[model samples]
Target: MRATLIYGAGDVRVEEVPDPELREPTDAIVRVVRSCVCGSDLWPYASRPATSEGGRIGHEFLGVVEEVGSEVSGLAAGDLVVAPFVWADNTCDFCSEGLQTSCRHGGGWGQDGVDGGQGEAVRVPQASGTLVKLPVGEDSELLPSLLTLSDVFPTGHHCAVTAGVDERTSVTVIGDGAVGLCAVLAAKRLGAERIVLMGRHAARTDLGREFGATDVVPERGEEGIAQVRDLTGGDGTHRVLECVGTKPALEMALGVIREGGAVSRVGVPQYEEGPMGVAEMFFRNITLTGGVAPARAYIEELLPDVLEGEVRPGRVFDRTVGLDEVPIGYREMADREALKVLVEP
Candidate 1:
């Protein structure tokens, strides 16, 4: 088997690795049919110190069940399924409350000896809880979109849901990355009438419009704030989705949100200090919310829409590569040459 490994900054390689096998009764082995590089994967690729022995990389994937552990039920060989970025035991209290990302027994891929998703196979612990079975097969045209359910789509939905986006609300989504674009789609699906996408790239923003962005702001900082405010009739949007986890992006989100509105951030926060102080939010009467998305909780709710072709989040994948070409895929995305890359193993 071969899997992607990051040896250091700007260095990603697909090399032969050991095959995965069930090590727990709740585990299942999935033969990956498709996987992809995530924007978050770039943080490590751009800054992690070099290492001689790199670890497995990737967390978004879907495939056929090759085997299931003794305790695993309601799933079996040949079942097509999507694996969420985080693996959680659905029986935990947090999971019961729809917060699987905080599950007591849950963890992320590429940790605790678990295989990463960008490989030939993955050992999925708590299979019954972590993997969602798809009604379609491996060859289905909806594979790419179904794969988004594993992470990006659910994450974008989380941003919208946390921001309180609905038909009555107006939204401004920050960032033009795949996640940002998906947030636009999610906002539309949730019935947001006015969506202002803050992105500089024409190509990506065009897709954002197709996904339902009513306006695109190609500026940043104060100029961007002015643009959004002008679009919203001099009053900032009622809700804002912060899809970029940086100080500037966070600042922009707060800057353009209505005084009584909320900002929901799903982007992987990259800063150490708080992006906004207590006084800042207090004075504005703004609500700040959103954390790691509980993707497991939203998969079932979003699956039917994807299957019905009402939303095609998969269009975000502007490039594709084989397992051996993953390093190139990473580079393309990192360089902004691609919006997202789909890895077909």
Candidate 2:
């Protein structure tokens, strides 16, 4: 078997690794069919210190079940399933409350001796709670779209859901990455009438329009904020989805939101503090929310739409790579040469 490893900054390698085995009764082994590079993966690619001993990487994938633990029920060796970025026991209190990301018994991929999703196979913990069966076969054309359920799509939906988007709401989504574009689609699906996408790239913003963005602001800082405000009749917007986890994006989010609007950020924050502390959020009566999306909780609800071709969030994947091409895939994403890269391992 071959899996991806990060030796450090700009160092990505795919090498032969030990095949995964069931380590717990709640575990199952999935032979990965489709996976992809996430924007968040770039943080480590850019800043992680150099190391000779690399660690496992990647977190989103779907595949056929190759094995299941004795205690893992409702699954078999041939079931097609998708694994969310986190493995959570759906029976936990947090999971019951629809916060699978915080499940008491759950953890992330590529840690704790678990295999990464960007590989030939992965050992999924809490198998019954984590892996959702797919109605489509291994060869379905919907594989790419269905794969987004593992992370990006659900994350975008969480951003919209947390912001309370509806037909009456006008939204401004920051960033044109996969998650940002998906946020636009999610907002549209939830009936947001006016969608303003803040992105500098024309190609990505073009897809944002297809996903239902009514306006695109390609500027940055004050100029971008002004453009968004102008689009919303000088009122900013009812909600703002901050998909870029940087100080500037946060500042732009607070800057372009209506006084009473809420800002939901699903992007992994790169900064510890920002402009939303007291002056912006407190005095303006604005709400700040959003965290790691409980993607496991959203798969079932979003699956039907993907199956019916109502939403094609997979369009965000503009490139594809084999297991061996993952390093190049990372470079392409880092260089902005690819929107997202689908790894077919």
Candidate 3:
């Protein structure tokens, strides 16, 4: 078997690795059919110190069940399924409350001896709890969109839901990355009447409009703030979705939100310091929320829409590559040459 490994900054390689097998009664071995590089993966690819021993790299994937452990039930060989980025036992209190990301027995990929998702096969812990079966076949045209349910789509939905977006709320989404664009889609699905998407790229923003953004702000800093205010009749939007984790993006989100509005951030925070402070939010009467999305909790809710072709989140994948060409995929996305990269193994 071959899997992606990161040796250091700007270095990603697909090399032969040992095959995975079930080590726990709750585990299942999945034969990966589709996988992709996430924007978050770029952080490590750009800054992690070099190492001679590279570890398995990747966390978003969907596949067919090749085998299931003795304790695993309601799933079997040949079942097509999607694995959320985080693995958890669905029986936990947090999972029951729809917060699987914080499950007592949950963890993410590339940790605790678990192989990452970008490979030929992966050992899925707590298979019954972590894997969502798809009724469609392997050759279904909806594979790309179905794969989005594993992470990005639900993450974007989390941003919108946390921001308190509703039919009467006017919203502004910061960042035009895949997640940002998906936020636009999610906002529309939730009945937001007005959506302002902040993005500089024409190509990506165009897709954002298709996903239901009523306006696109291509400026930054004070200029961007002025533009958003102007678009919202000088009052600013009632809700803002922060999809970029950088300090500047966070600042922009704070700046364009109305005095009584909220900002929901789903982007993985990268900076340690920023304008976020008690006085800043207190004076503005703004609400700040959002964190790692509980993807498993939203998959079932969002699946029917994807299957009905009402939302095509898969269109975010502007490039495709084979397992061996993953390095190139990473470079393309890192260089802004692609919005998203899909891997067919």
Candidate 4:
């Protein structure tokens, strides 16, 4: 089997690796049929120190079950399934609370000997709790959209839900990355009447509009803040979905949020410091929320919409590559040549 490994900054390679086998009674081996590059993967691709021993990378995929441990249930050979970005025992208390990311026995892929999603196959721990069986066949054209349920779409939904977006609330989504675009789609699905998308890329913002952004703010800093405020009659929106995890993006969200409004950030934080001190948050009574999305919890909630073709979150994938071309796919994503890259193993 071959899997993607990161050697250092901007260096990604697909090399032969050991094939996975069930090592736990709750485990399953999935033959990866579709996988993709994630925006968060670029952080390590750009800053990881160069080293001789590369580590496995990638965290989104859908596949067919090849084998399951004796204890595994509700799944069997040939069943099509999708894996959330993180693996968890859905029966755990944290998972039962809809916070699978904090499951007592949960973990992530591409670490500590666990096979990453961007590979020929993966060894899934807590199989029955981690893998969701898909109704579609291997050849369904909906595969691309269905894949979003693993991470991106659910993340966007988290942002909207956390911020209390509703038909009565106005929304301003920061950033136009895949996750940001999905945030727009999620806001619409939740019945947000007005969605303001902040981004400069014409191609992406255009899709943002299709996804439900009623206004596009292509500026940054105070300028962007003013644009969002202007759209809301200078009062700012009721909710701000900060989909870009940069200090500047956080500042913009703070600046554009109304006095009592809330901000939900779904983007993986790229910086350590921001304006969230007493003067920034306390004075305004602003609510700050959002973290790593428990995609496992939201998959079922978003699956039916994907299957019905009501929303096309898969539009985020602008490029597709084979397992052999994964290196190229990473480069394309890092260089902004691709919005997202889908890998077909």
Best model number under lDDT: 2
Model 3 segments more than 4 A misplaced:
none
Per-residue lDDT of candidate 4, residues 1-345 (tens digit): 999999999989999999998899999999999999999999999899999999999899999999999999999999999999999999989999999999999999999889999999999999999999999899999999999988999999999999999999999999999999999999999999899999999999999999999999999999888888888889898899999898889999999998889999998888887777887789889999999999999999899999999999999999999999999999999999999999999
Q: What is the C-alpha lDDT of each candidate?
A: 0.94, 0.95, 0.93, 0.94
Instruction: Name the regions of candidate 2 deviating beyond 4 angstroms.
Output: none
lDDT of 2 at 64: 98
RMSD of 4: 0.8
Per-residue lDDT of model 2, residues 202-291, tens digit only: 999999999999999999999999999888788899899999999899999999999889999999999887775678888888999998
CA lDDT, candidate 1, residue 246: 93
lDDT: worst 10-residue window of model 3:
272-281
For model 1, residues 1-345, the per-residue Cα lDDT tens digits are 888888999988888888998899999999999999999999998899999989778999999999999999999999999999999999989999999999999899987799989989999999999999999978999999999999999999999999999999999999999999999999999999999999999999999999999999999999999999998889899999999899899999988999889999999888877646666587778999998999999999999999999999999999999999999998999899999999999
**What TM-score should be assigned to candidate 4?**
0.99
Q: List the residue pairs that clash in candidate 1.
A: none
**lDDT for residue 195 in candidate 1, whole number 0-100:** 97
**Total residue pair clashes for candidate 3:** 0
